[model samples]
Target: MRGKKGNKEVLKRILLCIRPYTSLVVLSLGLAVITVGLTLYVPILTGNAVDYIAGKGSVDFGMLGKLIVLIIAAITVTAAAQWLMNHVNNMITYRIVQDLRVQAFHHLHRVPAAYVDSHPAGDLISRIITDVEQFSDGLLMGFTQLFTGVLTIAGTIVFMLTIHPLITLVVVVLSPLSFGIAGFISKNTFQMFKKQSETRGELTSLTDEMLGNLKVVEAFGYQEKAQERFEEINERLAGYSLRATFFSSLTNPATRIMYSIIYAGVTLAGCFTVIAGGLTVGRLTSFLSYTNQYTKPFNEITGVITEFQNSLASAARVFRFLDEEPETEDSPDAEELTEIQGKVELEDVAFSYRPDQRFMEHLNLSAQPGQRIAIVGPTGCGKTTLINLLMRFYDVTDGNIYVDGHEIRDITRKSLRSNFGMVLQETWLKNTTIRENIAYGKPDAADEEIIRAAKEAHAHNFIMKLPQQYDTVLGEDGGSLSQGQKQLLCIARVMLDLPPMLILDEATSSIDTMTEIRIQNAFGKMMNGRTSFIVAHRLSTIREADVILVMKDGKIIEKGTHKELLKQNGFYAELYQSQFAPS
Candidate 1:
């Protein structure tokens, strides 16, 4: 069973989204009332026409014409009212969907980097787009239709009873049975729809994964395997969709059957009353019309109820995302750093991606301002983990990290991160103009400043040679540029930011020897007067470091200048010889 508190809370949140449109809601309800009033006059008009035609009452042509005119006027008014109600409903839905999308996006931005890393991009995209759209279509339209159906049903039933209590009994008797069928079908359909949505999310995740790694899939000849996996998900989704349709489709037919039975019973009973000289033709005609009107709202009500159930299921998923807690940040009183010299120190910092294992423990290091420090280690030796901690991407579990003598946790993350620039091994570039990509780091930078930064990164000459020079558009992920050229553009972006501290994690690892030399030269200039942390697998890149730290198994096994480390002849010496020695 669903918790009562949870249902109430979710409904409260959904209602809050529409609170701003209460005036429109009021107008819609008012229109619905007018529509009901107009439709209720139809049965009375039919009764009057029957009496005049039967000649059992005095005939008045003028009065008959007026009654017919009133019937037509009522229909016209109902149509206009319905149109206005629909427009208001659409406006309210639009406003609510807009607010929901914005709020979901804002929450996503505030979530922790770890949460983002752990969740699939495709799944997140589906929740924001498809799930939210489902909620809008189902919850908004379903509820509006439901409200109108209820009002129509109530008004019709009350007027119906006023005509003849005996006929009203026939209609009311079948209602409970009709509702039971609708409720059962709705419950089954809701389950199937939920399953369908879940399958769709999985299919979306699979497609995104394949597309993101298309090159690898092609190179490894896994296209067939990927397709097979996707087909499995698609097949499951189709099954669930079909099941939902099968169940929901029963609602209208079952209600129609009950409506037919009630109509037949009422017609038979009216004939008996007329033949017994107890009821006139006009009264019987009016009762039949009322019976039809009464059943119509039940049909509509049943359909809306089914739709509401399905929508509620979708809405539950959407609200779950909205309720997610984002990553926490520093308190309002957190310290702010205006300027940083980039003196960094890490003492006994321990961390683990999982609770049962430790990736790093008791790690100790320090770097002076403007000094170039290099970290070298084997694969999975916590080299990148150290950089992550220093950048405060993952807070240390055990010890303190200080930059310029201030505890990292005490400072606002934005203020702390503003002082550092990073260039990763895989350079990422947006599908945009070269000029815009370079200026991305500092959006306010002038064209001349961008070009100057490009020159400083040794990327200006090559950029000028492109088809449109700086204005040339890059393909997705900078596909238009060679690997080395893409790396050059990344360096230029970093140069534009010109942070006080820098982390170069295998920045030159992918470039050719010739490009590597140019990058190294540009890097030396950029490093001047800035504290630098260099993680290099290629030992030659870090020969000029003011200090070198050798790490193994999350511990800093050795630390010293290059000459001092060579004399120690430990892990660093072994790693250097292993790479440079003859094959």
Candidate 2:
């Protein structure tokens, strides 16, 4: 179920990410305490040394020497602790961010195909990459400055109280004003930062769209329009960024002004105490130093509030994605198909993308162990949807699909999908060597096996012409390869696996007539005893199918052998005529 996540929940999740690094967290915290404690004690040592130095030579030289050395030692230790603390903070922040990115990536795999299909890839990439990096920045500040600042403030208060309660009371009363200012500004900027984050995601998505389709944009002379669109998004992001910065920036000066009042009040009250003999001059000096130490952290806190707000916004985006409801998992008792014979059946199947609109209904189909079933239909006629159902990418709304007598829902999705080899119209080749692309479906396949698959797909000859033959590295999505070549690589990938069943959805549309003929011959041998479902817009590709199903409006209206359907002169015959008849 989808749910709105609050800041507390998002923070809680971040803490959970940190749970694995408990030792590091504890060490950083300990270092912060040591650093702040020594930092606060330094003023005391300085004040005592001030008391001992009555005049130049009249000063107690021996006592001053010990205080000077002790002060130096404390300062050195504080510096060292602070450094170690920062190093630890970085470790925790980056490690947590690393875990978060890994988890987000793996979560995408479990999410429904519908989610990936419907969402913009660029937006998701931004959340996983850009947003996560922003969160890391915020997290590092939170771990180091936030923690140390709070500790320093607390330690200063303790020292002030031990020395004189009345002055400490004044400082404590003025402290809430600082918190109030920081809180107000942070709250205002939080929404702006969130808006800024979303705008950035939109901008990234637009840029990715333009880059991925650079050829189309250039061909259509749409550079000016694309730039205009980019400028609009970039402008909106700038506005949001400026507004958030302006508001959060106020926290610093405003808090500093309030702190100035606290310093003034402490100085006036502390002077009166020294005059009345209630406080010593040296103690007064130490108390004043404590006052500055006490207020310094508030300044530091407010200064970082802007960065923290941005971090929180980015974190919220990441958490929202991580919180998405993953696809329904298989039941515990889901059976595995160890030995499949390629028989498939759909009984009274009903499906739809939306509940209010039914697309396919009461659909029934059966394929014997070895048969070629060609599906012919116009666009939006459920041709691909049927294949999706068979692959278990989407479950049927009613009835059940069975493979080898086992209900598909009852069988594990992995095993069911593994038994089917699919090649789609859109070719997707990883940026790797030709051998790896061909062996993608079966990664452990031998080089000889990969060569055989490439040969079957009529891709081996062209691959050999490359610099490294099978070892030739391809560029993004098969690089500068022609559409036909790319499609052949995709075909080779599936051929390498050679699963028990096959689904080819316009898989050969990009290949030339000569290559298509050879591939068809290869498929003829491959489909000898395997159940095959071929979805083709070109009527001639499936002329020899044992059965042809003509679909309209998501329902099968005609089914027969190609010759039998031609004899019926029904919808299937009409489609065949449209392709074969003279213009």
- How many pairs collide in each candidate, listed in order? 0, 0
lDDT of 1 by residue, 308-406 (tens): 655566667677777777766797788987778889988788998888988889988888999999999999898898888887788888999999999
On the 0 to 100 scale, the lDDT of residue 578 in model 2 is: 86
Error of 2 at 51 (Å): 1.9
TM-score of 2: 0.95
What do the candidate models score in CA lDDT, each in turn? 0.84, 0.90
In model 1, the clashing pairs are: none
lDDT of 2 at 517: 94
